[model samples]
Target: MDLATDLELDHLVGRARRLVVPGRRRILGIVGPPGAGKSTLAGALVARLDGEAVLVPMDGFHLAGAELRRLGRAERKGAPDTFDAAGYAALLGRLRSPEPGTVVYAPDFDRSLEEAVAGSIAIDPSVPLVVTEGNYLLHDEGAWQQVRDLLDEVWYLHIDDDERVARLIERHVRHGKARPHAERWVRESDEVNARLVATTRRRADLVITGALTG
Candidate 1:
């Protein structure tokens, strides 16, 4: 059976800190379905880790809006294919064995523009830990299958189903979608991806549930 623990933010932070190795970089991946607080928890861990960690979210790998449109995949933007999965895996490889004196720059997803902003995050090679969070880190299909082999540790976040759906809708609305449209997208699009992620829950090194701090 998979180990499921409800750890507080403090305990989680301490746990994350322990994963670091002297003179080597360790990557901790936080993965869950959309609206599962992956980013929130990731950011909290990074802030608490102080200078020891940097966050390089997988959302940064999203294909450009024009690319998605050109490929006629604009509707299901959060699906696995909407991202550059091979590129993400390659970048993870680079993160896993970071070279000395070379800073790895990562992109960030801009909610306001619904696009990826390049070189928005700088990962110093000396930082002991990299906390990456996203929906498909444990996904074992196609190009995403290689993700599991690269990360040092993986944590799966769990939340109430209703709460997760509600949060997704609220997030869409906050990002400028109409309430009805947001609800439809959550029901039709996001939930479909959520089910896919659920299948990979048992693959995580740890399963985290409960109210998160920070």
Candidate 2:
């Protein structure tokens, strides 16, 4: 089956028109550059599902702000090394086992503090689908490689280059950056990260355009 075609949907819904049940322990990975609306699509997917679906964002694995600062990488916060990829891969591997009645705990990002809080969520094994999104899920390097193997499917969301930049600047501002500073960061920081993310696009099982199927 062509995954790209499966991602198309009615524009208003912002969801995939169909859900393919390839097998049990099905994990859907949404990979896209920053500001591509990956999280928005993940939320919509969870809302649209009848039952047995949950969101497990890769952002939860981000290294603590203090850790980034300690490593002198605060300015590169969104870079691949700024996340605990090994830990994330391990968790995904465990979740793929699908142990009935067992619960799996996962970390979550605290946007307010810009840090990762451990054990922010508990995934009940009864959930049949986990909608996970992140920039580096398809990165074929070290621990990131394991992420792809764990996922049952992966989708890459795409948006216009100009629009992505616009959204990134807006996001940075809403997240506390000053206007001019936000624009600078989007161009220098976010776009650099976006370039790295683009390399993983071809690895996606599906490629979606616009907000209609993020």
Candidate 3:
């Protein structure tokens, strides 16, 4: 079900709404390769749902740049090993079980700094739904398996390869990378992660395709 039209968005919203209950929290995951518009779709869902939902991105669990550097994984920054997958899963578990009068704080990714900012997002117990998007939510290996198990539903986004690659390069350049560097990173690093994520598409509850424009 592609979220390219208002009717499709309505269907997506309706599905998310059905998961909400009076006293429990439900999580919906948006999984896709980089530049596939996962974040954009997640944001649109949250906006359409208003206060009923909040966004908690998995990018927040990314390992600090220093840590990546120490581990010699700086060049492969988007790989599975570069994130705190266990921590993300634990947070999802907590979010799934809401305690009255308690607020859960989640981390957010600071793209400019290339690091995670702890306690940057507060998920109030009143928020019945959580929309978390990332590249690895549907992945089946290691701690990522736990992440897949924790989500109530996951949707995978698919986009044309040429368009996805073009968007990736533009994104990197907008975020301060030189054009040459952005192209190289997309080809060498992001593409590797994208291929890994593509293998997980069959596991998603729904597959979204089409041009995603925001």
Best by TM-score: 1
Q: Compared with the true structure, what per-residue lDDT tens digits does model 2 show for residues 1-214?
A: 3255433444423333244343466788889999998888887877777565778899999988788889999888888999999999999988888687789988888877777888887888777778888999999887787899898778898888999899988888888989999998888878999999998888887788765543
Candidate with more favorable, higher TM-score: 1 or 3:
1
Which residue pairs does candidate 3 place in steric collision? none
TM-score ranking, high to low: 1, 3, 2
The sequence of per-residue lDDT tens digits that candidate 1 reaches over residues 6-103 is 85898899899998777898999999999999999999999998889999999999999999999999989999999999999999999999899999
Worst 10 residues of 2 by lDDT: 11-20
Which candidate tops lDDT?
1
lDDT of 3 at 17: 84
Relative to the unseen true structure, what is the C-alpha lDDT of residue 205 in candidate 1, on a scale of 0 to 100?
A: 91
